[model samples]
Target: MQLRFLLCLCIVGALAQSDYDEDDGAEGKKDPKEIQDPRGHRPVSRGRETYSAGPAAPPPISGGSRYRGRPTAAPVGKLVLEKEEQPDSGGCNHMSEKMGVLCPTGCDLKKTVQKQERNVRPTVDQLKRSVDELTQSTNSVYGYVLDMTTEVAQRQRVSEGNGLLVGQYTDSLETQHAYIKDAVDITFPQNIKILQAVLDKIREKIQRLEKAISAQRAKCQVPCKVSCPIPVVSGKECEEIIRKGGEESQMYLIRPDPLGMPYKVFCDQTSKNGGWVLIQNRMDGSVDFGRRWDDYRRGFGNIAFDVGKGHCQTPGEYWLGNDRTSQLTKMGPSELLVEMEDWSGSKVYAQYEQFTVQGEATNYILAVGRYSGTAGNTFLNGATELFGENRTMTIHNGMMFSTYDRDNDKWIPGDPSKQCSKEDGGGWWYNRCHSCNPNGRYYWGGSYTKYMAKHGTDDGIVWMNWKGSWYSLKSISMKIRPFFKQK
Candidate 1:
């Protein structure tokens, strides 16, 4: 029994030793290197001494031989103690504990972080200052841009205003230029014509003056027994005299007469110190007494009595004879007279005087008379008689004369177609003879006498009336006198 006990004791002791080796390290102490953290910090080391609270109680020995080969477990409390004693053996949960225990590398990290923070502070300040400068510069640029914009707008407005003004001025100038051009176009030619007319008048005067000078020189050099006398009047003087006559007579003295005497001649009796003398009458004694207007205009046929014929009568001249059927005979130049014998054997006559008018010698009758008739018988009896007798005088000289008609108080002229009536008896020729005897013992004569004998008379009167009607003239005595200028 003693030997068996000894073997068992030895086995038990070996088991306990094995268990201690497994539970604790082989040295039964923690290594500082193994306790280092992931942050590279080493744990503070405890002294290399054995750790014991007191003597531990022995574990219960197993009686069976099965326990002989097996190791024993340590106490639970001792395992927990071993875990707590290790340095940095825990995970990230132990980082707080290492905060107070810095390693060499940890100090370098702390210093680097502090240096970077210090550098960042200055950089932040510089960045803030740079930002402020940039903002201010931007504001300034914006203000400058705004000012430029405003100035540009203002300049644009001014330009626009100037453009409008320029446009208006251009339009005004154009209008004025057009007006001036039109005025010049309308007046320029007219002004030229007026100037040319004035120049022509001046040239005519100069020519007249030159001719007068030549005539004066010739008159002084020549020695003749007789010299031509200067003219008593000129064309201008004749016009003056006519104007005076118009003023005195209150009449328009122009040809062809407005009363329809187209055969009238305008005699400028300037050289005879006379005014206008009209020659207008029909001398032809044909049965058809109406004169042609064209023949009268050309002074042809019976209207050709001019100054060259003096007082001689033409082939178809007028005649008043006792039988009233004798051929007409011309009078002598010196004794150019128109005479007729009344039923009482009294001689009635008309005489003329000769004068020069506008370089043409003409004869103008001044008086008509009944030399052996009763006193005042040569004077006109009625307006119609005066008109007829004045017409006879006009035929002798182919001249128109003014005869005062007492009935109408108007001058009568020699126009065959002139309007006449008892109410306004103021024309040489008449279609009706008023206040006279048509079929009395005294004869009534005129252009209508022959027509009256052929185609009977109406109301005891004869006339070459319009529309082929015929009428006879009434008997009335009349006398005529030439019209002279009032000097």
Candidate 2:
């Protein structure tokens, strides 16, 4: 009986102690708003930007602090900006002027996380892009080699078509002239007059087919690239380029045959119905397909090519003609359109035309004369020329800003402005920044590189296999040495 009485008394004492502890603990609980960080600072998010970092000690709330009825969701540091002008002693009495070093640049402290993320994203993406460019080039080699051989063969088969076409036209002209001279053949001038009318009608029809060629040359120019993947507009507004996009557009070389090597080409020419072509050759015994793509915004299609070392050719005239439907896609304030040939001859043929639109007003600004040539002709000495004349303008966009070739084991530079921004640790460079997608695809201006790095490209360039051509965007431009073939 005495043991049971003692146990009941002990239970009553324990209950009293428990109640006392609960009341005291409730009073001591953290305010829940005050937070801590490893840096011994409290940062408050202000809007999307501003942040104030203070020492470990809690900051004092001043009359300057504005409460939005409800407590702010952003960190207290954000509200601290207004305090920036005030001495450090105003916020957390413990902080010293040294802590003021935490002041952020124009960049907001809130951007810290985002900034770090950007840095990592591009490095990884570049690696993958480099690999893809390698694969693309390999495939392009096969296609380019085949194309080179085919061009040579085609030239042989139709070796005299150009001359034949000229002769046919001249013969037709002569036949008409003969009718004019021999009035007895028709017993009157009416026969000659009738033939002349027919000829005029035929000429008109032919002129319509050659409108692209005529319109461009009549202006003392050819189609040119007027724009590239320019910087994004500052705001939601868009803008178009006012001048041509291709500057320093010059010859590059390629080797299409196993035994063939690069040569320097300085002269090439073509006649009406022909189009512009650039034939390039590489110093290294390899072949590159001769397909040129204007920046995506001004989508110019493929044209005749004579891609070999030192290959330089004037635009060519053409005889065959076909109608094609071109497509258009606008980028930003400027409208970007792509006009490609629906049907063309063996040598890839296309033209790049650029025009700007403002309200309802439109102005044609630039055109790129495209053509191709190869060492495929006997008379032209195994060299085929792809020519275009319906364009003339200064077009330059330093694409191919970066390129790396495993075969050459070297990195080349393109244009600095196109590849990167001046802000980041590494300023802009052509080959490294602009040419291909940061992923190593051709410069379609689709994908963008991530955060700017001090030295972004390990290999220092991006190479792309576009269509059947291997194009390189180098980072550190040394010599743009390309060669033509001897086959």
Candidate 3:
């Protein structure tokens, strides 16, 4: 607003300056014979007339007089002689000299000079004042823009903080609501139930409002000029993006859930007939995997660049977040693919025909079936006999995700002292623990040394049946694609 006002003032000033120059040009073309009386008389009329005097004597005037003697034969304006006492001999000697004029009659030169000085001085002064005002307005506008930028930055920071707070609050409510409800019901019965009902209504309203806000944010998040997919109605996943003319394996925006804001995802357009969303990738150790529950829920690392850190030269190390993964997979029939590379450059993969991740209410439970690939089916039945009878319990299928902060693994209820994610230094689905711990620590070499193990566990990225628990893979990626049946 301030910028617009300053621009208007500048335009007005320029127009005023232009108009003043035009007035000066018009003044230069004024008739010499038509002069206004400084003391409020009518303009003198111009006519052809001749003045005859002895020897056509030069008009007596002092200091660069404007008047010139008119020849008897030449035509000139008739000079109006005012009624005034005749001047002394020293003054201009002409019929018009008695009125302080001379020859083909210029105005009293003194009065013309006084009128010009009077008109021009104030105009110049006004222009100077206008220039100063414009400069001041420009300074003010610049200051306002700077302040507005700072305010917007601060608001963005605050908004991010609020998002974090909302995530935490929602997680707590989802995780512990059963316990909270039981406690409240026992304490006050009817009164507490009424209050709880009111709270539920308020929560529902908040959720609706959040969905509305998310929709608005999705619309504005991507620029119109960009080839970003339309939110809510289209481009729900990488497959949808491919169908809509997307040809490259690059970062694309998608909104899997209609009530959620759009987010960036790496689309693998050339992999396995295309239309795969890269969910997790770890080639280098640039990004730490030992994050808390909220971190896993919201994701971390950079998804814009597909290449990871350091020498591996593959997709970057990042987690796509549990919430978005669940939203994506639950949309329809989805397939999961896990790819890994050993130190010797040999690559292996595990593909699941049926795959889905439940929401946070189920602790983001993993569901996979019909596995077929080079890599062993460690997800359901490929744990070594290291645990003897407990080998079956090591399967990661149907296990809830666990993190260092929120332990939802099977070991947490049986033996609280043995937390899979805490001992492994990463978050993942654990059943007694995982057979394939892809989110585990990244080791420098294929084999993890005994000294590198934490709590007597090799937490390195391990697909046990393919490379054993002690061997840390060089690179690993987990991606998913929805199955689109033939029309």
Deviation from native of the Cα of residue 30 in model 3, angstroms: 99
lDDT of 2: 0.30
Instruction: State each model's CA lDDT, in order.
Output: 0.34, 0.30, 0.76
How many residue pairs in model 3 have overlapping backbones? 1
1 or 3, which is superior by TM-score?
Answer: 3
* lDDT: worst 10-residue window of model 3: 36-45
lDDT at 152, model 1: 100
RMSD of candidates 1 onward, in order: 33.0, 47.9, 34.2
Worst ten in a row by lDDT for model 1: 322-331
What is candidate 1's lDDT per residue for 411-468, written digit by digit as tens? 2434433323222222222223323221111123433333343223322322211101
Clashing pairs in 3: 308-316
The 10 consecutive residues of candidate 2 with the worst lDDT sum are: 319-328
Candidate 1 runs further than 4 Å off: 1-114, 125-129, 201-487
Q: Candidate 2 on 40-137: residue-level lDDT in tens?
A: 33334232323344543335342133333443354644444434334444343221333343333333323443544455456546655866787799
Clashes of 2: 115
Comparing candidate 1 with candidate 3, which one achieves the higher lDDT? Answer: 3
- Name the best candidate (by lDDT): 3
